[model samples]
Each structure stands twice: as C-alpha cells, then as structure tokens.
Target: MTKLPSVSVVILNWNGLNYLQQFLPSVFASTYPNLRIIVGDNASTDSSVEFIRANYPQIEVITNDNNYGFAGGYNKVLDQIDSDYFILLNSDVEVQPQWIQPVIDLMESDAQIATAQPKILSYKEKDKFEHAGAAGGFLDMFGYPFCRGRIFDSVESDNGQYDDVKEIFWASGAALFIKRDKWIEVGGLDADFFAHMEEIDLCWRLKNNGYKVIYCPDSVVYHVGGGTLDSENPFKTYLNFRNNLFLIQKNLSFFHASIIIFIRLWLDLVSLLKFLYDGRPKHARAINKAHTAFLKAIFKTGKKASKISTARFNGTALVNKSIVWQYFVQKKKTFNSL
Candidate 1:
C-alpha cells in the first residue's frame, strides 16, 4: 500500500459560521486518512467562534481580531502548518468523502507538482459546475480567470465536460491542496492582495519555478458560489474588474505586463461604458476605484520585483501570448457574462 501523506486542511472563514453548517460535515467526510482540520476564523461577530467550539471540539481553530481578507487570514495558518501537505479550502464549499486521496496520490507520484485541485461542482444544482473553479483554473493572457468547463458566467454542468486530469495554469483556492514546505518556500500568498487573485499569484509563481499544477477531476466537490459578497454587488464587480491587472503586473515580465495592462485598461473602459448603459454608474465608480488601487499597488511594488524571490519563470512569459490570442485575436472571451 502507498503511504498516504499527512495533510493539514485550512479553511479560512470571514463571517461565515453558518457556512460551517454545510461545510464542516462534508470536510469531515474526507476519506483520506492521516488528515487534520484547522479553521482560521477572521474577526467575526457572528458567533463563528462559538459554533466551532460547540461543534468541532477536537478540531483545531485559530481566530483573528479582524477580517484579514482571504490571503491575510490564510497566512496565519500557513505559518503554523507543519504537515506533509497543506490544503486551502473555502468555507463555502462541500467536499466529497474521497476528495483528498487522489490529490495526494497524484502529488506523491509526481514531486514536481506544487498544487492540485479537485473537480469543483455547483452547490446550488449539484450536477452543475461552480463559478469560481471547476476542473482547474486557467488564466487568459490578460489575467482573467476561466476553467475548462467553466467560461465566465456559464458553468458547463457536470455532464462529464471536464472529466480528465490535466495540467493547468492555476488551481483555484476554493479547493486547493499543496505540499506544506513548498508553500512556505514560495512565500505563501501575498498579503498585499488583501483578497482576490492571490491564489493565481501563488500558482503562477509555483509554475514559474518549473513546478506543475494539476487538476484531479476524480476528486470532486460542491461549491456554493459567492458566499461573502452579494452576486450583483458593485464591490465584487470592482475587485474582479481590477485584480486582473494586479496579478498580471506582479507576475508577467515588464514588456508583457505593459501590453496586458494596456489591453486591460481598454477593456475596463468598455466595461465602464456598459455599466453606464445598464444604469449602474456605481459599479463603474467601483471599477474606477479598483483601477486606482492597482495603480497604487504598482507604484508601491514597482521597485520590489527583484525582492519577489518566488518568480523564477522568466522564460517566454506564456500568459501574455495566450491571453492576447484568446481574448483579443480570437475574441473568444468566456466568463464575462458570469
């Protein structure tokens, strides 16, 4: 029998104690042996702490005084993780009993893989695919997120659409597994991200170092989309709108980053015009603010690229070329409507 590697599963919670109602049982059902569960709770006033204490008494729980966003909150547990592998899962997701075994099996078979994710399905319909991630997350050259079965707003229902395991550009943080030390060596997630796009940033760095990222389609799970932000909220729109630029700026080479930046700016302007047409000027303003935030972050990190010791992939800068062809030349953008 293969020796199953031990895993420390970290679920970051920001005010979603109730999500725990649906999530914890499914997590406990993980069929993989030698597993430990830890919940990292951000400063939430919603009885989250009480829920954990009352229910999962034997399970370890860590608490913060304020919402550190996803990246910040997960960083806390990352510092303390000493297991063979570390798993980062969203509070809003429900995992299958057999989820982690295949992920760990694939990683053990290939030490080159730095991260792996399960096939993610929809929490609402169960047979449908989720919004954030499905069969592994891929990035357009412009840094927009799409998956094999899930383009923009349309999730290809689990009609065996993405049944194969394959290499991908990034793994969704929604249900991600990675070796613990590699995560620390890669510096974990960049806290400056506050929340969005941090997983792709880490996965990008992982791939840059000649490490592979895989999608283990056999390990399936259900995800309730958008647990924290309202689906139609303008703030969510702004974050999705601008964080693409942040990921591209931080990861891509200067020339490629510049090209993507220009393209993203143009797209944002068009999106703003669309928002204006839809009588949602507030969303347009939010997009403007997101852009401002990216500019501010760029000015702050511009001198710090060399300090980013994790980025070892300076080869052809693959993302730029792929994104340009898919979104610009091919004009086959997915997920814009979602």
Candidate 2:
C-alpha cells in the first residue's frame, strides 16, 4: 500500500473559543487518512488553547507569544510543523468528512498547482455562496477580488454552475489548501498585511512565480462569514482598502501598479462619498484612513515590490476589465454573466 501525503490543517485562532468549539468537530471528522489537526492560537486571552488541549487531546496546539493577526500567526505556527501540504482554515468553517482528500488529490495531480480552495458556502444561508470565497477567487484588472458565486455585495446560490475544477487567480483563505514547498517558496503570507487580502497577495505572488491556483469543487466547506471581524466593521473596511493597494504594489510592476492605484483612488473616493451619502461616515473615514496608511507605507511596500519576478500576470483567471463597472454599471452580478 502507498503512503498518503501528510497534510496539516492549521487554524489560526485569536480569542475565538466559541468558533473553535462549534467548528472543530467537523474538522476532527475529516476522513483524510494522513492528517494532523492543529490550532495556532494567537495568544488568545480566552480559553481557546485550554479548550482544545483539554477536549481534543490528540490535536496539537502551538501558541504564539502575541497575537500576530492571521498572516503572521499562520507563518509562525506553520514554520514549526513539517507536512506535505497545509490547509490554512478559518476557525469558523465547518467541513465535510471528505473535503480534505479531494483538494489534496487535485494539488497532487499537478506539480504546478501551488494552492487550491474548496467551494465555500455560507453557513448562515447554506444554499448561497459565502462572501470570502464562493467557488474560486478572481481579480479584475484593477485588482478587485471577487468569486464565481459572489460579486461585491451580491452573492449567488449554488446550482451546479461552478462545480468544475478550474484555475483561478486566487483561492479563498477561508479554506485555503497549499503545497508546503510552494507556501515556503512564496515566503508564506505577507505578515505586514496583518490580515485582509493577505491570501490574495500570496496567490498573486504564486501566479507571478508561474504557479497555478485551483478551485476543486469536490471539496466543499461552510464558512460563517465575519467570524473574526464583522463585515460592517470600519477596521475591516480599512484593511480591505489598504491591503488591496499593498497587494497591487507588491505583485505588479511599479509603473503598472501606479496606474492601477491612481484609478483605484478615484473609484475609492466614489465609494467614500457613497458611504457618506448612505449615512455611514465611519466607513467613509475608514477608506480615507486606508489611503493615508498606504501612502505612508509606499516606500516600505515598494521595496517588497522590487523583488517581484519579471513575469507578467498571464493567468486565465485575471479579468482585464474593471469588475466595479461590470457589477454596478453593466449590472453583471453573476460570474457567468461577467
């Protein structure tokens, strides 16, 4: 009999004991033969580590000294574990027993397939796709991240439309499966990103290195969106707006990134105004804070950008047009429509 590849499903936790208690059982029930379940606790003041250690004695717990956020927390924990593959799962996700094998099989089939994600459905509304990553993640020419079953605020219900395995620009972080070597090659997730868009940045960098990101529909997971931060939180807005610029800056050429950022600023301004008009001034101010932070960190981010490979982004998943226009103006809400 052949030995199965060892896989580690590492969940980064920061004061999410409730999520851990609610979701860990489904993960423990994963039927993958060679699997290790680990909870990388980000110095949670809550009893998350204690709960895992007491209840799931077989599970491994690696506690960080301080909360390093998602990117840094995962990097710290993953560096300690040796495995053929790593699944960076969110704490709030519920998995099927067979979710692990299909993704591992897909990644193992292709040497170039660096990372992949399962079909993510909303835990609240099981019929609909989740916002973080619906089927597979894609990026517009301007660097806006969307998924097959989700575009902006609009999410689509699953109806076998995106069940086929396909290459994508980015895989959702909620249930991201990545090869161990590929994860290390890209230097893991950018810790500077802190959290939001970090997965997309990682995927973009992998694509830049001529690796393929895939979506395997055979593996599916339910994600309770906004587990760590609510969608309406201003800080979430800040991270999404700011880290998006960081993503473009680190992955694309200086000239191209500048052009895209220039256009994005105008588009963001419109969003800010819309927030103000809608009586959400906090969100409007959050965008302002994001741009300000991005500008301040330009020199630091540019240094990272300088290391990018000369290879241009030629991924099949990269849409050459603005998704904002497609969704809002053209009213192309569904991925098939777009």
Candidate 3:
C-alpha cells in the first residue's frame, strides 16, 4: 500500500464538554486513514476530559491544569505535532466525512499555499453561513476579516460563489489547516490574542512570508456557532475586542496602524453613544473593554514597535482606509435591509 500523507488534527477544549458530544463523533468518523487526532483540554472542571477518555479511546488527549484560553491551550500541543499538516479545529465544529482529503489535496497541489479553510455552515440555522467564518478569510488593509463568500455579519448562504479555490488573507481557525513547519515558523497563533483574531495574526505572518492562505470550499463543515462561549457573552466580547486591537499592533506599520486605530476608536465612541441613547448599558462592557484594551496594548507594544515587521514579504501591501468601520456599517445596512 502506498504511504498516506500524515495529518494531525488539533482540537482545543476549555469546558467544552457539550460541544464535544456533537464534535468528536463527526471528527473521528473522517474517511482519511492517515490521521492523528489530539484533543487539548484546557483543564475543564466538567466531565469533558473524562468523557473523551472513556468514549474516544483513540483520541490523544492532553489535559492541562488550568484554562490557557485558546492560544495557550493550542500552544500545549505545538511541540507534539508531528505531521505534514496541522489542522487547528474548534471543539464546537463537526466536519463532513470527506472534508480532510480535499483540503489536503489542494495543499498538495500548491507549494505557495500555507493555510486553508473550508466553507462553514451554521448548524442551528442550517441554511445560513456561520458568523465567525465562511468560505475563505481575508484581511482588509485595516485588519478586519472579510471572506471571499462572506462580508462582515452578512454570511450569505452557500450560493456556489466559493466553489473555486483561490488565495485569501487568512483562513478560519475554526476548521483551518496549516503546514506544520509554517505553523511553527510564524510562532503559531499570537498568544496575546488569547482568543479571537489569533488566526488572522497567523495568516498575516504567513502572507508576509510570501505564503498564500486559501479557502477550499470542497472541505465542508457545520458549526454550532456559539458552543463554549455565547455570542452575546461579555468575555467573548472582551476577547474579540482586545484581540482585534492586538492583531493591528502586531502586524500593521506604524502609520498604517495609527489610521486603523483612530478609525476604530471613533466608531467605538459612536457605538457607546448609540448604546446609551438606546438605554443598553449592559452591552457596553464589551465595547468599553475593547476601547481600554487597545489603549493599553498601544502603550505596551510601544510606538517604536510599529516600525518592526513580524515577517518579511517581497512586497509591502498597505492601504489607507477604515476597514472595520466601513464593513461594520455595511454589515448593519445589509442586516437591516434584509
């Protein structure tokens, strides 16, 4: 028999036992034969660790003592990854039977491609695309995520627009594949992010190093969307807020970063005033933390660090625009118009 290419699937869990109920069965059922699944449990107090230990004997489980959050939990298995490809899948996602090989096939064909993601559909609203990622992910000059088939909050239904394989700004960390060495090369996901935007940070570094991120729509999966964290929850808000800012700090050049930061700050103020006007003080916590975290991160990353390039590309792709603000406004308009 010909030797199949080795692939390691890394699933990070943090008190996500409920998610595993739907996730593990789907993953271990993959059609690919050359596979190793590693479940990194971030010290869940729930029976998540035990459930996996008892039911999924084949899964290699790494149980940490405390919750390292997303970055820390994933970093636990970096030293243990020994495969051609490392798939960083969220515990909440359930993969289709043949998802892995199609992605692997695409990577096999392209030497320049370093990362890839599949078309993610929503499990709850079966006809809808999930919020976090859809098809392939991209970064605006301002560091906001826009996938080829998705724009901000408007995740268009799988309308065959993403059938073609092509380059992208980033791949969704939810069901993403990256070359093992490339993951190690860019230092994996930024630990500073702690949760959201880490994959964007990784892809930016990959692109900076002259590698391409791709969306392979043939690799399909259904995401429950909010599994371990509620979409409206405060910590999710904080992480999403803080991490997006941290990503800008790590990647953009000083002048470019400043423009993006100021735009975000001004929009956030508009959000706060709108919230207060609507008497929704409860929702302000996330935006408030987003506001403060950026300020602190700006101070910590240092004004001088903006001159640094985390990775080197043959070309410097810079833009003059407020990517997040424009996209969010458009997203709102799209949502309202719908």
Q: Which candidate leads in lDDT?
A: 2
Compared with the true structure, model 2 gives a TM-score of 0.99
lDDT of 1 by residue, 1-338 (tens): 96778898888887797899878998977777798899988888888878888988867888877788888889886787679999999998988788888888888888788888898888888888787777777775567777866766656767775687788888888888988878977889878777777888888878777788888988888888788887589878877766677787777677777987998899889889989999999998998998988887787655545455444662222334454445456666442322
**By summed lDDT, which 10 consecutive residues of candidate 3 come out lowest?**
329-338
Clashing pairs in 1: 31-97, 141-323, 151-335, 152-334, 152-335, 153-335, 153-338
Clash count for each candidate, listed in order shown = 7, 0, 0
All candidates: TM-score: 0.91, 0.99, 0.89
Q: Clash number for model 1?
A: 7
* Shift in Å, residue 260, candidate 2: 0.5
Q: Candidate 1 local accuracy as lDDT?
A: 0.79
Where is model 2 poorest over a 10-residue stretch in terms of lDDT?
307-316
The parts of candidate 1 lying over 4 Å away from their true place are: 308-338
Better of 1 and 2 by lDDT: 2
In order, the Cα lDDT scores of the candidates are 0.79, 0.93, 0.76
RMSD of 1: 3.0
Candidate 2 lDDT, tens digit per residue, 1-338? 87999999999999999999999999999999999999999999999989999999999999899999999999999999999999999999999999999888888899989999999999999999999999999999999999999999999999999999999999988999999999989899999899999999999999999889999999889999898899889999999999999998998888999999999999999999999999999999999999999999999999999998947554779999889989888999999997
Off by over 4 Å in 3: 303-338
